[model samples]
Target: MTDVQTDTTLCDPQDMAGRLHTALSDLVRDCKARMLRPRPGHQPTADLSGFRLGITWLAQQRQMDSMLDLAEQLVREAPALVGGHGRKPETLDQLRACMVPVLRALPEVNRPPAQRLEWLFGTLLVDELQCLPHAEVMAVLERNAFQPRHWQYIVPYLEQNLPKVKGTGLSWQGQERRRRLLGYAWQACQKAGWADRAEALFRRELSVCACYGELAELLVHRGDVEEAQTVLLKGIAKYNASRPELTMGWLDRLESLNGVG
Candidate 1:
């Protein structure tokens, strides 16, 4: 992860619009179809709950050391989860059973020196606009975005050594295409500013299969207590529980937002 300089706004509106336009154009070329119309708003309340549970369950599944092969097996059988939600587990026991391998392996796969993001993310950038799982990925990204203090466990990797496997930058056309496409998205994001992304976070349609208590809690920790409170209230109202996990996540988010402490 790059060191976040400051909480500077990213992707100014004018910049983001242009980037969005360019991304949409590349998307057309890649998909070779009429572009899908985009309607903004977060995920539905119900889906957010489902996604929240799904990820929680996913986190619980553990695999480690000698138990490691199970990580590969889990992805092979339940590939849908690599991206987003699906049918809930039949029972608490089943849920735990499903997640154990992943839980054990996460120490190994989580982003960093042992970064196995490649396996989970596959060929797609979790941050990419075209990916269906983007909303969930965005939550993960936001949780870590410009907030590096929490990642003390994962050893850092040099950005230079990290793979840029997206396009072999050899050919002129390939280089140009990559430039026009990614440059536009990044420039747009930087220009549009972080506020646009923050607004995107609050939308229910995009926040589906998500958790708000934690998100709200982060705002509170940041002294944006009102936003934090709102996120938590909405989450509890929707889910009908004041879970410790959510509580802890909120606190952690706040702590991280505040800095390494």
Candidate 2:
């Protein structure tokens, strides 16, 4: 039997919206202040803190307009804030470091139905996700696990924006991002008890080193050495010339397994 709980008192939506706006207003103010007097290094201590506070409140409120407004503003200003055009790369890097968290806080499943997911904004989000330090990516992924529907938006965004790998020239950063994205997406599926979904996602593309590594490792751990060997071989053959180091590592690991080294 399902137990049901009912709300005894309802909070006014308008009041919640007001509070959301106020919180976001403070975040925006802090962003500008921090931007004016930039901090040392690419560490975004203050700006990230402010964005976290506002985003936490925004999530609680579930106010789509407020969330979109903040997201749009941040996305629009990012290139400039990052000092696009002949500006110092260091400054842009620092700015990006500061903005990554704020951008990650943008609501995915809670986004308004009316809001069109722009490719440019999606591209920005992917870039931010890729550029974020590994530790931060894991943290974001941990949060994403609780929001299963977020993958509905995030996966499509990635499919559209994540460039396919080609030729012997590989963008290491892009590959790393793809690997992390796949890891998170697969983890999200697995956590939801969607084993088939996880397999499909992990096998969808060999765009990154870990895509093959993780899948192969899982298979090997599950006593499917032949399948694991095949997965690893395919990965090595496909990526050897372009990413010899990573593929070679996978090869070494595959060789250590019994049969079909």
Candidate 3:
């Protein structure tokens, strides 16, 4: 449950990785024992609670390949117990969540770049990759951004989903979610040294209304409060009539930036 800072120098990667690996191994062993002792004519249910606990442990470990083999094994064995795809079992989801951060931090190891990339984006795992949480996706992109193929894959995947946010017919919740996704993706791209690409994406796809709200927040975090205010003001003017509540929120942000309202 402790938050491990992403900095490798602050912690011992080997010790942390080994501890998590052993913990996950024990969990799988226990789950296997439970699966074998099912009631007569009834398949035993797989307990997923330990998987989440493993994921929490995995998240604290700095990104490293020391645990990749363990992750691959878990992924291979997960489907038999927790069927994925449309029926994304919680165990499989938790497994993917744990494995992604490790994969993202794999750049420190001197593995075969192409082979590791293939393993990270494996065919059997691509579907599950789409189901990764927003934070995990951003972490993966940020960690692998230096790799041309990784950057190439993430940018297009996000761009392809941009069109769905173009129209104004979306419900407020739908629009808000889209805005957050795009905004976080932009932040990820920027963190990967793709600020130009992020800006281009904002201009080409998200330069309006709620998306501007996202942009403003990004700027605010970047300490460009004035620019954030400008973006929100523009959004306020544009969305005031049809999206009054959203605009009001934007205006509130704008005024807060100026120490007013």
Strongest candidate by TM-score: 2
TM-score of 3: 0.45
Q: In lDDT terms, how accurate is model 1? A: 0.34
The per-residue C-alpha lDDT of model 2 at residue 200 equals 65
Ranking by lDDT: 3, 2, 1
lDDT of each: 0.34, 0.52, 0.55
Listed per model in order, the count of residue pairs whose N, CA or C atoms clash below 3 Å is 38, 0, 0
Worst 10 residues of 2 by lDDT: 1-10
RMSD of each: 20.5, 10.6, 10.8
Tell me how many residue pairs clash in candidate 2.
Answer: 0
Candidate 1 lDDT over residue span 1-261, tens digit each:
011111224423333333323432342243222123323443211122222233333343321321223323323323232222222332223323434434434444445522333333331222122222333323333432322332221211211111342432444344333323332233223333433333333242213333364345334534676565556556555544544554465455545544332
Worst 10 residues of 1 by lDDT: 153-162
The pairs that clash in candidate 2 are none
Question: What shift in Å separates residue 223 of candidate 3 from its native position after superposition?
Answer: 6.5
Model 3, C-alpha of 54: deviation from truth (Å): 14
* Stretches > 4 Å off in candidate 1: 1-102, 105-114, 117-212, 229-261
Highest lDDT against the true fold, candidate? 3
